[model samples]
Target: MIIVPASADTERGRPGTTQQFADMQAYNDQMLRAGVFVDGQGLHPTSRGARVTWADGEWSVTDGPFAEAKELIAGFTIIEVSSREEAIEWLKKWPASCAPDPGQHLELRQVYAPEDFGEEFTAELREREEQMREEAARAAARG
Candidate 1:
């Protein structure tokens, strides 16, 4: 996952400024051509979202408009890649015009897939996942 923090929001939707969108489109095209673009989208401000936390064996929900600008994630992009080095290379090429600082941070995080759990994930579960993969393949073919 690639995380865009505060700076992204500051540069968006201004008049006479469209290079950001074009740069993003170019990056998306490059990633797509490389077969690494799995999914990505920008997020709305914290005012439109909420957080549900589970603690003390109870559920608590907090409304947003969160105070911490640095903590709020502006967006995320998920990619399929062969190695961390490759991911880094891709991120290094990100356009400067897309954020307020003209080269704001983009965080790279490794996501845990079910297979990462090793033996704790039973064979039955693996079989179910394979079936689901097959179903997804079939659905894609239908389209």
Candidate 2:
């Protein structure tokens, strides 16, 4: 997962230019051609979203815009690559104009596969997980 955090300009609800979006689309196309792009999406600003938090054995919903811009995610990209280095190489090609100014950063996090959990993750569990994923894909396709 490539986590795009909200920048200062993003927190202010600044929108990307048409050219920037075109550039980003081109970048995404390139990644798709390279067979590394699994899925990706850009997000609207924090003002249009909400957060749900659990505290003191209860749940609370808070409306945006959230005060901590840096802690908020603006978007995400999921890539399928053989190595971390390959993923970083793809990240390096991110379109500069597509993101906000002043400060911008993307975080990389590895998604855990069932194998990563070792023997405790039983074969039945793995099979069930795979089935669930297949069902989800089918549902999405139907939609």
Alpha-carbon RMSD, candidate 1: 3.7
In model 1, the runs with Cα more than 4 Å from the true position are 8-17, 99-104, 129-143
**lDDT accuracy of residue 30 in candidate 2:** 97
Per residue, candidate 1 scores C-alpha lDDT tens digits across 42-102 of: 7777777788999999999998767776676777788899999999998887766665353
| lDDT for residue 100 in candidate 1, whole number 0-100 | 35
Tell me, by TM-score, which candidate is best: 2
Candidate 1, lDDT over the whole model: 0.77
lDDT of 2 by residue, 33-80 (tens): 999888988778888888899999999998888887768887888999
What TM-score does each of the candidates earn? Answer: 0.78, 0.88
Residue pairs with colliding backbones in model 2 are: none
- Collision count for each candidate, in order: 0, 0
